[model samples]
Target chain A: MTHDLTTLVPLPVLIPLCAAGLALALHRHPRAQRTISVVALSLMLAASLGLLVAADGGPLVVDVGGWAAPVGINLVADRLAALMLSVSGVVLLCVLLYSLSEGMTESADGLPTPGGEDPIPVAIYHPTYLVLAAGVANAFLSGDLFNLYVGFEILLAASYVLLTLGGTGARIRAGAVYVVVSLLSSILFFVAIALAYAATGTVNLAQLAQRIPEIDPGVALLLELLLLLAFGIKAAIFPLSAWLPDSYPTAPAPVTAVFAGLLTKVGVYAIIRTQTLLFPDSPGVDRVLMVLALLTMVVGILGAVAQDDLKRLLSFTLVSHIGYMIFGVGLASEAGMAAAVFYVAHHITVQTALFLVTGLVERRAGTTSLDHLGGLARVAPGLAVLFFIPAMNLAGIPPLSGFLGKVGLLESGVRDGGTLAWVLVAGSVVTSLLTLYAVVKAWNKAFWQEVPAGVTRDVRLPRGMVGPTTALVAFGVLLTVVAGPLYGYADRAARTSMDGHTYVDAVFPGGSERGRGESPEAGGGDP
Target chain B: MNPEMVPSGVLVVAIGVLFAAGVYLLLERSLTRVLLGFILVGNGANLLMLVAGGRAGGAPIAGITPVDEMSDPLAQAMVLTSIVITLALTAFVLAMAYRSWQLNGHDEVADDVEDRRIARLAARNAPVYRDVDQGEAGTLDEDAAAARDETERDEAGDKTGEAT
Candidate 1:
């Protein structure tokens, strides 16, 4: 059973990659491209769900090319990884559907008339989207540090293409900042990996977990800080986050939605994995993380409060809420990790749903500028409902997944009882209230105010687009409904991760030397 | 760990200088310079990976060299992968820079529009956006009196004037 599941682990990464090639081949046939993308992603989603169930028993590890763990690239679908993959799988599929519908609507509206802003470059969009999905899955499942870096590069590369699609002046401007910043981060991460390999002679994460603690304390801290720095920029934690809001709001809506939803969380996921599995007892670093989390929350939401554009505001809130997950991680407790996991899952769905709704709003009102949007509640009541559920949920209203995730984090924060943790708790509460105020202000301006002059109200939202967005919103609500089992799984995942041996042992059974094709000179294999 | 496998100081110094110059160029506004900086930094990192592999030695082909005399093949393999990735990304950044040049007649990175708008508003001491709930610019008493709808005025208007 475990071996069968191990085979399933690579499918999430493989299927989309293969499909990407096929989709590119069929690009001339947009119909075939759409079919390939949808079918491929749907299959990947199913594989991810299967992995999620199998991972519940224990992590399923696959040494790629049949090489042993330490010598070859491996993919491990552990509980945390499987959960991330499943959530991302769901998000990727929904966004693909939404973008496809958007493309259809654009062409239907008589787009692609010679020189009229080509309709989303349908030929390139499907392929790049699939590659992005593959990259994200690979990142979630990678067991080797270098493989993880490869995954990051894959996703970042795809994102750069998506962000600057159509090469508009605004997009080019934003992409420049985003690309340069991401390149710098990747270099830093590359340096870190090299240094880590120098220090410990291996980059397999499970092996690193064993060796890292044995290295010089200063060297270990250096490696940890370097990794954190790279991930911090990617995750958009306060001082490193200014580029996100500027860059994200310029992209087309579905592209921005997926970037907003999944990309930063991948970084957060990395931090969680590394902190728990590799450096488990670093109180000092955890405290610093706590401080950073507080600053990220306060500063990010404050930025959100000042935004006039709906996408920009949501982007800022996305940055702020990441702090909540960071806070949960910094607490370094099981409950905290569990809450952080749940929060990540909840935030991904809500943030993407809100962005999708913003896309709908833009379609209806001809802009995402809150200052110009008005009377949406009366003009497009369905869009209003779609927007409101996720908006209020994002603000942490009761009985929603967002509220539950926040409550879980706050409870864990109070349980932590340290001074920094208390401050973070207070900071989180303040951020939540400010978030409420900001979204409410936006709600009033965009949905309730009198319709501004010259704004059209008669544009209808395509059912195809609305269907995916509503399904995603419903999925978010279902998270609240099934909070019991999900939180339980998260708690178990946290416990397993917090005890690093479960992971290490999973990779190297009976303590070592179980995988096939182990090279003799690799030192752990038979001499 | 082998005692004789220490890397040369020259390579270390070279890596340092490359990174320093790369980061310096990276801070420049020109996208071309940024791309150049990225290339420099990428090469510097590749060199660092080389240094991490220990002193250079013969290839690890089975009969060509003894295991002890062979350099760490894994690091070399990783460096090769990183180099390819860097090359691909360099091409991408180059294309983007060209696109920027084409679009704006210069490849200099521009400021965020929203940030600039907010800065302008701050300089002028204006509210970010007008809020209807704030009830226009007025003192509390004046605004409250203006907000009131008097029945007497309504009745008089209905009887004698065009209330509609």
Candidate 2:
């Protein structure tokens, strides 16, 4: 049934973007707005799954406005993009459910009251969040550099709204920092795109993949460096990552969770895409990536150890684990890339689930600070269970998907053995163990430790919140249950990425060399 | 393809200066300056696209200018797109600065308490601390004293004592 569902490829992105406007228009009727968003994302998830299935057979490409590749904007749903889209769709759906359950769409307060006085607050969150999802989908599906930039901007603009939902002092403070940092990254990205177009006279990824390798060595290196810098800031690699630990923890829980789970991964995805597709054979560049990977892992985990706040600890670990993916990327091997893809999928699910559980912790205890939070296990075993599963999974506990991902990556790292690879391998293990220690410490303090004298112990456990948490946790476990198949998918996707010619052909069908600007042919250059 | 209306050399120098100034302002504590620096960088990038288009000849307007005679229209489109993006995002940042001022009466992006603590600790870990013992041995050097004074400054700069 999904054999020829290429037509469904663009629907995942197009639906949510159109729904964002529809949702905003119906903001006065939040029920209608909620219905629109839920219906739209549900459709997105379904279509994305279908696309994922179809893309496994082959990549699907579409040119918007009937324009050809190189001239018109294109959307390509290859295996990796399909995996990202489907997984993110599921995550977004769960987050939206959690938000609705938590009354994030209803009141100025995190808590819900029937018919709250403030209309704009409730009205704004749904549309912006959907727009953010749309932007993410657009980025994954976009086949051109300019469209990718547009995708980043779409999500970032939505994120500005999401980050400062309540306009509280700390939220505003953090939101300002996030906006500024993100703006800088986007501007750099814009500059990079311009420079790339100036050099190659084309912004299409497939075409660039063909032309970049043939360009002047100096210009090519400069373009690659510029792109790396832009994406590095976006991905928050070690030296460039300081802004993340500060900006992320201050947003409301679901927003923070979504940002952590999918936003940074988008940057990582772009890195993987550009490095493999555009500048595939840069050996020196791979080494530099390896060094950065090692540093990001060690520094991020050590920072996690020093944190007393659960959210901050998770944020650090988030940065640390990005190193693991980079390790895979740096290996520049099929196995390495496969493992990286698998790890990205696993991390996104587990991280979002952790933050969702953290939100529950906040809702139940009024804080996530380990100093104030204690004995959660005794009062709320269910919340403790919810937190414990994803937390352990995040720490790479055996039999969980996280462990499987780590082992896959380690195996690949060991296979791609060199001095740098070995160092990265050691760094990955250390990061894993430190991650375990940090989460365990949280487990000891927030769950197992004695309840403090004055701290509030029991609170209403809303199913709206708890139910989605359980669902996501179950999904994480399910990844483990299907590890064999999921890893296979990752391996295949990585193989596809390793083979760049397929991507170019899928986009151009009959090679980009044939099209030498008919207009340019009319003007001066060879016809 | 329009004749290289803007000299390539001038644009590269302008972009370099603009990018340098943008990076400088971004490093500062002030949000307004950061915005201005970003604007400069954006204009510089736009100029770069123009230079990338090759020596311009004419506008690549269909049914009019010959293709070979035309300026690179795609490059022009991308620049227009980037300009729009920069304008929108810069406005958003301006709003963010305004909100921050309204909330805290400052446009500075304050370093997180945890980050400051980490920095202070890292600063303390410098090899200069090993010279504290060296000072007792008759070589109370400038490096050691400077390091000590820097630590003292960090201690004074942060009012909240470390808890752990």
Candidate 3:
């Protein structure tokens, strides 16, 4: 059945946001709140799928309050957006299920409650989780740049609550860093948006696509640079990524999973949108992106290598791998953008799976430190397998999604035939080898060594936890096998991105040429 | 376009100064000072926004004034949005700080100087174990640094233990 736009577009964002209010109000009723959270997310998943199918090649745009383009707020969902929303929905579902199980068991077993009075710490978890999910969904679906900023605010606001959900000292200290850095980034993002709107007199992506090209070369560069800096800080590129590793690993496992899964990708998505739609040049912005990608790759992986904690190592690896996707964007060709899209999808699944596996490690070993954890393979072969597949994939081992994505990126970079492209190709190759080493280090230290004494090894995997972990792992594996069809989708997405005329037409029909304000020939000679 | 009026470069320098100050104060021990630093930094960023948008308009909304006479109202709207977000962020941070003080008995990064020092001293005082003892199976590992620190604190019978 065909989906109605009015119902589908708004519900995906509105349901969880509404559920956040509901969850907060029903704080005393733990089960009711949890049920409501699940129901809201489930509906979001359905709606996201509906929109994805409906908006495969084309886009779905609805101007809120009946305002026309350039004046009113619009919510547009193209294939890339739809793909992100679907990925976010799946990850949120997994995280929610895992949280529910963890919360229930902890509540029942007399785990040291946060407030000491509330036996079930349901009051805190439910509302915050719902809000975080709502924020993520909003971010994925938002059309206008300002609207996306709002979505980011919603997500980060909820994240502030989630990061410090438990008032532990470590969580508090880490939460402080998270809040300050995030605040700074938000401020920068606001400034960028303000500058962009001033320069172009428009905030809508399609409208900005029309106006930005006509702007002076210097002005255009400033706006693009400002926006890039804001997004870069959020995306955790090499120099901008210090706060992430320090803060992310300290939060609860489920929160960490969701954050790792969806948040940074939103930043990457924004960069891709701005780079492709706003400025399409062979060497101008693409060169800068290429440098950032290479540095982000090399530095992030090296940081990962130094970390003794599994979660910290993963966090660093997270930053390192962002380079691959950024490299894809840097190429600015159809294949390059396509490879980036493919990498983003692959990275989300693999990264989220790896974080969830850390949760499993935390549970079985009683600590996430590589020094403290050992012989997990012998004690818990199932958990070992769970970790191994994604670990191998993340390292770009053969017959996995990571390998397919990197190969696509590398091939595209090689074909692009620029100095930046060659650097990206070589950087990714080096990153892959380093990533493999880091993964091997974690495996050898945590899974292959002898177990310490006085630790009664409970290798028995929890029924509740294993389900979500297995599902994520299977999804990553499926991406590997289904690379052909997935690549076809990416190919279409990349073409639409490169040829902004298609996206502009999707947003403003009969005004396609009108939307491209200044022709490339009229502008600073194609940079 | 008037360099004799407001120099945009000064605003950039101001943003740099504000960011430097914010980063410095945010790294300080006191939570309150950190909050003030953030506020300053935020204001500086908002000023930067004002500059970036070409520094030439009142607001972007229509119907309030003559179309030709009106300023870039978009920057004004952005300022309003940034103000709202900053207020919300400040409130959240304050709430977190209050909650943290209640939980940990201090607003400083380190919860208690004396206790932390004592714990470190106790760790220095304790004997290190190279090998895990099989006999200690089922019994908690005394050599476990974290657990040992906890035991040391418990043995010290300090006032900080009561906070927990």
TM-score of each: 0.92, 0.90, 0.84
Residue runs of model 2 more than 4 Å from their true location after superposition: A1-4, A105-119, A512-527, B1-7, B118-164
Instruction: Give the candidate number with the greatest lDDT.
Output: 1
The local distance difference test score of model 1 is 0.86
Candidate order, lDDT descending: 1, 2, 3
As for lDDT, the candidate ahead, 1 or 2, is: 1
Q: Give the interface RMSD of each candidate.
A: 8.5, 9.6, 6.4
Q: List the lowest-lDDT window of 10 residues for candidate 3 chain A.
A: A518-527
- In the order shown, the chain A TM-scores of the predictions are 0.96, 0.95, 0.93
User: Chain B TM per candidate, please?
Assistant: 0.74, 0.66, 0.57
* TM-score of model 1 (CA atoms): 0.92
Give each model's clash number: 0, 13, 2
Docking class of 2: acceptable
Instruction: Give the alpha-carbon lDDT of every model.
Output: 0.86, 0.81, 0.76
Estimate the overall C-alpha local distance difference test score of candidate 3: 0.76
